[model samples]
Target: MSVLVYTENWDGRFKKLSNELVSYGSKLAEMLNTSTTVLSIGKVDEAELKSLGKYGADKIITVTDEKLATLDNRAYTAVIAQVVEKEKSGIVLLSNNNTGKAIAPRLSVKLKAGIASGITAVPEKTSPFTAAKKVFSGKAFAKFVIKTDIKILTLAQNSYEIVEKTGQAAIESFSPSVSNDLIRTKVINVEKQTGKVLLTDAEIVVSGGRGMKSPDNWGKIEELADLLGGATACSRPVSDEGWRPHEEHTGQTGKIIAPNLYIAFGISGAIQHLAGVSSSKFIVAVNTDKDAPIFEAADYGIVGDALQVLPKFVDAVKELKSL
Candidate 1:
């Protein structure tokens, strides 16, 4: 049984998340003593598809159908399930993003595969097929043992390193029969957000909380994010109060992000907020209270009024850039 990675493309192009999945799949293939095969479903270009080899993909399969461009849970699940069977893949990998979360359950049901969702690492040992993921909202870890012949795993983002290996993948075209009845979702129009970093894709994220005092005080927060070329996020309360858009909310009840660097200003670091960003590589917190919960998790912390400290932080970044 080989390893298969179901990579979802964005606008006919792959994202860094896709490469990360390929990298993880390649590692799993090595552990399983098999080859790596990637299935790309959408109207994607050949050149872009082959680029996955840099991350250790052995073979690339493309299913070019205009109807499959948009994600329909039923349709995409069928397509991936079909590929898994055709390749005789024992382990199927996907990202824990919106698309992955949407289709993983359906694919699991269709393939009768045991699913380990939101896993942060590869199998500790594949003997009994032992895999571990964060449990209880990242407060702890739990290991799962699957006896099923087929295993489906959805990996958490930013958890695996993307490694490059020498190989030029052989490309193959796949045309799976997608029943029209399975394509139930219809797209009317797409409103694209332009000229800002996407929170999910950002390496660095600057966030503000209710401690910012007023919505008018967010200028410095946005400026800091812009200076660092990162995305802007907020606590859930900030979103609920309409101080910021709901899309910027990051928490257990909202978006879960694990950026390389997460900076929190005016956020008190409630457990709910920590649940979302606890996985960040580096956390920088600035709050007035020294006993704020954020400091416990922060790699670097400044205890002072966030409003007072923000201007200084902005100036420091500007000075460093000018130098």
Candidate 2:
């Protein structure tokens, strides 16, 4: 049985997260002495599907249907379960995002497989498969063991590095029986977030909290993000105050992000907020309080008012860029 990785596409395109899943699945397949196969749903183009081979996908199977455009948990689970059985997938991988959270458990139950959600590392053994994951709202870690015939894992975002091993992928299409009755949800409208970097896909993120004091004082946050080619995010309070959109909210109660470099301004670092961003590779915090909880988690800290410090940072970066 080959390793199966479900690659989620966005408007017929793949992102770094998709490449990451394929890479993780590929390495896991090598550990298991098997091949890695990718399953793509939705309307992805042929060339885009083939490009997955660069990330170590040996074979690609695609399913395209208009009814499958919008996510219906039941229909998606059925589709994945059918693929797992047909391909005899010894292991299945998916991203631990909203989509994965929606259906991973159902897929496990349908296929009678053991599932480990939010797995952060690859297992070293196959006999009594073990996986590492975060627990207690990122306050601690735990190792979970899965004992079953087949193993299904939902990988946490940005946990694995993307590696490129280019090879021509064998492409083929699969037609799963997705009848009308299976789809319980219907898409009435779609509001696309365009013209800016998708926060989840951004490697670097600049975030603001309530310390800025006013929504009108957000120019430097946006300026810093633009200069660094990163996306902008805010704490829950900023969103709740209507200073920013809810989509930009990052915290345990909102979107959980793990960017390579996370720069925070004026944030007090509440436990809920820390739970979401604790996984970031590097955190730089600028807060007025030296004792702010964010300082404990930050790789680098500056005890200064963000309102006074942001303009200096912006100018320094601009000067550096001119060099």
Q: For each candidate, what TM-score against the reference? A: 0.98, 0.96
- Give Cα distance to truth, residue 148, candidate 2, Å: 1.7
Worst 10 residues of 1 by lDDT: 63-72
Q: lDDT of each model, Cα atoms only?
A: 0.92, 0.91
Per-residue lDDT of model 1, residues 238-303, tens digit only: 999999999999988888899999999999999999999999999999999999999999999999
CA deviation > 4 Å runs, candidate 2: none
Clashing pairs in 1: none
Stretches of candidate 1 off by over 4 Å are none
Name the lDDT of candidate 1: 0.92
